[model samples]
Target chain A: MIHKRITKRKIIDKLVFFLSSLSVIIAMIPLAGVLIFVASKGLSAINLEFLISLPKPPDEIGGGIGNAIQGTLILIGLASMIGIPIGVLAGIYLAEYGDNRFGSLVRFMADVLSGVPSIIMGLFVYVAVVLTTRSFSALSGGIALGIIMIPIITRTTEESVKLVPNSIREASMALGIRRWKTILFIVLSTAKSGIITGIMLSIARIAGETAPLLFTAFGSDVWATGLNKPISALPLIIYRYAISPYANWQAQAWGAAFILVSFVLLLNIGVRYISRERYKK
Target chain B: MPHSFFLFRKIKLKKIKRILSGDFIFKNITLIFALFVLSLAILVFYELYSRSQLSINKFGLGFLFGREWDPVQGIFGALPFIYGTVTSSIIALMIAVPISLGIAIYLSELAPGYLRSPLSFMVELLAAVPSVVYGLWGLFVMVPWIRDYLQPFLESILGFLPFFQGPKFGIGMLAGGIILAIMIIPTISAVSREVMLAVPNAQREAAFAIGATRWEMIRVSVFKYAKTGIIGAILLGLGRALGETMAVIMVIGNRPNISLSLFEPAYTMSGVIASEYVEATQELYLSALIEIGLLLFIITLLMNIFARLLVWRMMKIFRGAKE
Candidate 1:
C-alpha cells in the first residue's frame, strides 16, 4: 500500500510540474503574439520618410509620424523636469526621515496614486490645468504624464536610496560633513545608478501612456508650435489611428506602435544593464 | 580678552545660521515635496467629487443602479458601465488567477535556476508592452482569433450556459476579459512569487520530513502560508482590470447595454470616460462622465488600499516569523 501511494504521489508531482510549466507557456503566448504582430506589421511602414515627414490624410498612401515623435520627445523633457525633482526629493524625505505616521501615510498614498488609472490623471489635469488655460497643450499633457511618473519614481527612489548602506552616511558625518551634505552628496551619489534605473523605468512607463494624452495633448496633425499649443504623441497617434476605420491609418498605427514599443523596451533593457552594473560593483 | 570673547560669540552665531540654512532648509524642502505626494490623492478625490456634483445632485445614488445611457435625452446611468467593468474584471480574475498562481509557483519553486531570470524578464517584457499596443494587437489579431476559433469552441462545450449562448461578435466582454487577463498576469504572478518566496524554507522542509512529495510539500506548506498574500495579489490584478481603458475600449465593442452573455458588446467606466469625455457637449453629460470617473477612482482606491494592507500584513507576519 505504501509503495503504491509513493508512486501515485510521484506521478501527481510530475503532472503538477507539467501544468505549472504549461501555465508559463500560456502566459507567454500573448506577449509573443503582440510582439510578432507589431514587429512584422510595423517594420514595413518604418523608413526615413516615416520618421521625418508629417502624416498624410487617411486616403493618402504613405505618411510619417515626425510631429508625433517630436511632441513625444518634448513632452518627455517637460515631464522629466517636473517629475524628477519632486519624486527624488520626496523619496529622500521618506528614506532619510520618514519613520513616523506621516511618512507611512505618504508612502501609502504614493502607492495608491501609482495604482490610480492613467485616465483619471488626465481628467484631473483637464480640470486643473487644461480648463484653466482654455487650451489643450503639450504642457498639460506633460503635467498629466508627470503626475503619473511621480509616485512610480518616488517608490523606486525610496527603495533604491534605502539600499544604500548606513555606514556611508556615518562615514560622511564622521568626516565632519554636514547632515544635508552627507545625504545629498554621499548617500545620493552612492545610490545614483539605482535611482537612475528607477527614473529610466518611470520614463519608459510614461512613454507608453495614451489615455492621459487624449484630451490634454488633444493630438494635432501639424507640428506643435509651442508648449501652449496642441501636440501630437506617438501613443496618442497610435490610439487615434487604430480606432479609425481607414486601413491606411491602422497601418500607420502599427508603425507608431513599433517605435513606441521599441523605445520602452530599450529603456527597460538599459535599466537592467545599469542595475546589473551596480550589482557587479 | 573681551575682543576674543566677542569674536568667539560671533563664530557660534554664524554656525547656528549655517545649520538653519543647510540641514533645516534641506529637510523642509524635501518635507514639502513629501507633503505634496500625500496630498495628491486627497486632491484627486476632491476634484472628482467636486466636478461630479451636477450628476450627484441630479441622479443621486440611483445613477449606480439605473441602466439608461441616452446622450440626447441626457438621461445617463452608470449601471451598464459598472456591470461591464465588474463582469469583465471578474472574468479576467477568473482566468488570470489560476494562470498567475501557476506561473508564480513555477517561478518561485519549480523552475531551474538557470531558466528563472530569463523567464521572469520575458514576463516583465509582457508588462512593458503598452496598453495601446495591446489594444492594437487585440483589435487586429486576438479579436479575429476569438471570432474564428475560441468563442465557437467555448459555445460548443458550454452552449447551455448564458455566457456561451450568444453570437460571437469577437469584440465583447470575453475579449476584454482575455486581454485583461494577459495584461495582469505579470503583476499577479510577480507579487505572488514575492509572497511565496517570503514563506520560510522551514515550512517546506517540515512538509518533506513527513515523506511528502514536492508538490505535496508546496500545496500543504507554501500555499497555506502565502494564502492571504496571494489573494491580495489577485485583488490587485482585479483593481488593474477594473480601471483598464484603451485596450478594453478597442475590443469591448464600446456599447452601453446590460447583458448576461459574454459575446454581447459592453462598455466599462474607464472606456466610456475615454470615448465620451471629449465629446460631451452637455453639462450634465460631462458631469455624468466625471461621476463615472469618480466611481472608478473611489472603487480602485478602496481595492488598492485593502489589497496593499493585506499584502503588507502578510509580509509583516513573515518578518515577525524570521525575527
Candidate 2:
C-alpha cells in the first residue's frame, strides 16, 4: 500500500488550505501598517502647547488644535443630547411594544438609515438647518451627527433589550405595576449596560466623521463661541490640514489624527472588554 | 368574569379619563418616536426632491444617463459618478468577499483557540480605525505604491484588456477599490465568522465521519449551512463600499468621467457629492448634487433592505431548525 498517497484531491485540499491561511496574513498587513505609521508620526505632534493653545497662521511653526478639540467635544455633547433620547426611546418602543407593522417599518428604516452616506446626512442638515439659520452652526453639525447616531443606537438598544429574558419581564408585569413601569424599571435597568455600550459605540462612530460635519460645521479660524457660528472639529481640522500645502499644518493633522485614533481605538477596546466580561456572566 | 367586568369598566371610563394617563401617554409618545425613523427618510426624500426640482425639471430623465458634468456650462449629469460608484463597489466586493470568507473560515474552523480571539479582535480593531485614517493611509502610502509599481505591473500584464488601458495614476478607481476592500474586510469577515460559528458542531462531526478533509468539511457543512448569512454579509459590505465617502473621495482622483479602465481617475456618487456640494454655488449644480444624494440614498436603502431580507430569512431558517 502507499505509505503517503499523493492523490490529486489531497494536493488540491492542501493548496486551498494554504491559500486561505495566506489570505488572512495579507489582510493583517493593513491594520498593522496604518496603526504603526499613525502612532509614530502622530506621537511627536502631541505636546502641551499643541493641546492647549490656539492655532497659528498657516505660515507659522507651532500651533495647537485646542479650538478643534473643544469644538468636537461640544458638538459631540450637543449631538448626544439630541440623539440619545430619541434613539433610546425609539429603541424602547421597539423592545417593549414593537410587535406590529410599524415596528418592522422602523426596523427597516433603521437599517436603511445606517446605510446612508454620511455626506448625505450633512446635506440634509445643511438644507434643513443651515438654510433656515442663514449660517453654519454647531447646531447643524450636531443635527448631522445626531441623525447618524439614531440608527446605530436604535439597533443596539433593541438587541440588548431583547436579551433581557421574557421571564424577567413576566415577573415584573405579574407584580402590580403598569406595562410602561415594568419596561422602564425592570427591563431597561437590566439592559442599561448594553445600551450604554451602544451609545459609546455610536459616539466613537460619529466622532471621526468628517464628511457629515464638512458643511455643517464649516470650519473655524479662531475659537468660535456658542452653536451659532461655524465650529472646527477634530476630523474637519484633520481633513483641512491634510490637504493644505504647509508642512506644519500637515504635522498638526497627524497629531490630531493620533488623538482621534487613540480615542476611538481605546473606546472600542474598552467596550469589547466590558462586553466580554458581561458575556461571561 | 372579573376581567371582563374590569375591561368593560375601563372602556366606559376611557371617555372621561384624562388623556395624560401614563400608559396611554407613554405608549403613544414612544410610538411617535418610532415613527420618527420613517419620517426621517420621508423628510430626506421630500427635501431632496423639492430642493432638486430645478435640476430635475431641467434635465428630466436624461440627467441619469447624460454624461457631461461641466459646472461651467451649467450642465450636470451623474452617469460617470454612477459608473464609478458601481464599478468600484463591485471591485471591492470581488476582492474582499473571497479574502474575508477565507479569514472567516480560518478564524472559525482552522485557527486554534489560543490564536482565534486575538486575531478576531485585531480584525475588529481595523473596523474602528476610522475612515479618515484609512483615507490618509491610502493617499500617503497606497496611492504612490500603486502608481509606481502595481498599476505599471498590471498594465504590462493585462494591457490587452480595456480595463487596464489607462495611464498609471495611483489615485484612481483601482486604488479606491483596494482601500474599500480593506475597510470592509473586518465587517464581512466578522459577520461571516459568526455565521460559520452558528453552524452546529454535529455537521462537522458527521462530515469528518465520512472521508471529508478540513476544506471539504467546511465547504459542505459550514459554508453551505451559512450561505444565506454570508450573502447578507457580502451585501452589507457592498452597501458600505457604495456609501463610503471620505476614503473613496481621497483615493478616487475625483474626475467626472467614465471609462472601462480601472487605472484612470474616476468619481463616485458619494465622492462627487462630498467634494463638490459645498462649492456648488450654481442653482442647477447644487440641485443636481442634491439629486445625486437622493439617488445614492435610494440605492443604498434598497441594497440594505435586500440584505436585511436575506438575514431575516436566515433567522427564520434558524428558528425553524430549532423548532
Candidate 3:
C-alpha cells in the first residue's frame, strides 16, 4: 500500500512539474509569431522601389516609405550625436568618482528615468522643446529621443566601467599617472567592449520608440529635409498606417512593423554578440 | 648662469604640469557632468512649471480630480485617466506576478538544462521587442482574438461578476491589462530567475537533507531565501506596467470613465497625454497633461527607489548569510 501511494505521489509531482515548464515554453509563441509573420510580409515590401519610393496615397496599392526611413536615420543619428558624449561623461563620473552622495543620486535618477514611460518623456520634450521651437522639428525629436537614450547609456556605461578591475587604475596611479588619464586610457579601454555594447543596445531601443517622436518630430506625409519641419519615422508611420481605415494602409503598416522589428532585432543581436565577446575575453 | 636659468625654468614648468594634470581635469569634468545629470530634474521641473503657470492658475488643484476634460469650454480634470492608470496596472501586476513567479520557479528548479537557456532567451527577447510592435499586435491580433473568443468564455463563467459583465469591446481595460501583463512578464520572470538562481546551493541541500522533495525544497528554502529579490522583481514589473504608453494607448479605447466593468473602455494618464497632447489647444488642458506627466514621473521614481532598496537588502542578506 505504501509503495503504491509513493508511486502515485511521484506521478503527480512529475505532472505538475512538466506542466509548469510547458507553460513557459508556450509563452515563446508570441515572440516567434511576431518575428515570422513580420519577416515574411516585410520581406515582400523591401524591393529597390520600396527602399527609395515615397509613401503613396490611400488609393495606391504599393508605394514605399523612403521618406520615413531617411527621417528615422536622421533622428537616430542626431540622437546618438547628442546623447553619447553626455551619457559617457556622466557614466565616467559614476564609475570613477562615484563614492560621493551626488554620484549615487545621479545614478538613482538615471535608473528612475529608465522606468519613466516613453510617452511621458515625449510630453516633457513636447512642452520643453517643440512648443518652444514654435513647430515640431527633427532636432526637437532627436533631443527627445536623446533624453530617452541618456539613462540607458549611462546605466550601461556604469555597469561596464565597474566590470573593469581596479588594479589597472591603481597601477597607472602608482606610475604617477593622472587620475583622468588612468581612467580614460586604462579603465575605459578595458571596458570598451561592454561600453560599445551598451551604445548599440541603446540605439536599438530608441529606434523603435514611437511615442516621443509623435509629439516632437511628428508626422509629415511628404519628404523632410529641414530640421524645423515635421519628420516621418518608421514607428510613427506604422502607428498612422495601422490605425487607418484602408486595407492597403494596414498592409503598409505591417510592412513598417516588419522593418522596425528587424532593425531592432539585428541591433539587439549585434549587442548580444558584443557583450558575449566581451565575456569571452 | 645659463645652467641656473635652465633649472629655474624647468622647476616652473614642472610646477605647472603638476597643477594642470590630465587626471585632475578628467575627474573634475566627470564630476561636473554627474552633477548636471541630477540637475536635469530641477531643470525639467522649473521649465514645465514656468510654462504651465497659466494652466495652474486656471485649474488650480481642481484639475487633478475633475472628471470632465472639455477642451472647448476649457474644463479639465484628470481623475478618470488616473483611475484607469492605477486600476489597469494593478490588474496587470496581479495577473503577471504569479505567472512570472511560477515561470521563475520552473526555470530555476524544474526545467532540463537544454531548455533553460533558450526559454530564458525567448522571454528576454519578448522584453526587447519594442512597445510599438506590442501595440500593433495587441490591436490587430490580441484584441480581436480576445473580443471574439476569450470574452465570451470569461463572461460565460464570470458573468455575474461586475468586472466581467459588459459588451466584448476590441479595446478596454481588460485587453490593456492582458497586453501589459504579457509585456511585463518577461521582465519579472527574468529578474526573478536571476534572484532564484542566486539562492545558495547549501540552503537547497539542507532542505533536501531534511527529507524535502525537490518542489518542497524550492518552496521552503530557495524562495524564502530570495523573497526580497522576488518582491523587487515584481515591483520592477509593476513600474513597467504603470508607465507603459504606446501599447496601452493603441488598445485602451481612450474613454475617460471610471467604471468597475473591466470590459468598458478606459484611459490611462500616459495614453490620454499621448493621444491629446498634440491637439491640446487650451492652456489648462496642456498643463493638466504636464501635471499628469509629473505624477507619472514621481510614481516611477518612487517605485524604482523601492525596488533598488529591496534588491540591495536582499543582496546584503544573502552575502551576510554566506559570509
Against the true structure, whose lDDT is highest? 1
Query: iRMS of every model, one decimal?
Result: 0.8, 1.4, 2.0
Q: How far is candidate 3 from the true structure (C-alpha RMSD, Å)?
A: 3.5
DockQ of 1: 0.82
For residues B181-226, could you state the per-residue lDDT of candidate 1 as single tens digits?
9999999999999999999999999999998888999999999999
As a whole number from 0 to 100, the lDDT of residue A82 in candidate 2 is: 82
Write the residue-wise lDDT of candidate 1 on A16-112 in tens digits: 9999999999999999999899999999889999999999999888789999999999999999999999999999999999989999999988987
Over 4 Å off, model 3 = A1-16, A170-176, B1-19
lDDT of 2 at A70: 91
Across A1-281, the per-residue lDDT of candidate 2 in tens digits comes to: 35355375578678778877887898989988888878998998899999978888998889899999999998999889888989999999998889789898898889778877788789889878887887999988998999999999998999999999999988877887877888889889999889999999999999999998987998897887878989998998888887778888888888999999998988898888889888999
lDDT of 2 by residue, B128-156 (tens): 88898888878878899999999889988
Ranking by lDDT: 1, 2, 3
DockQ score of each predicted structure, in the order shown = 0.82, 0.71, 0.59
Best-fitting candidate, scored by DockQ: 1
- True lDDT of residue B315, candidate 1: 93
Candidate 2, residue A163: how far the Cα is off, in Å: 1.5
* Candidate achieving higher DockQ, 1 or 2: 1
TM-score of chain B of 3: 0.91
Q: Docking quality tier of candidate 3?
A: medium
Off by over 4 Å in 1: B1-19
Of the pair 2 and 3, which is ahead by lDDT?
Answer: 2
Ranking by TM-score, best first?
1, 2, 3
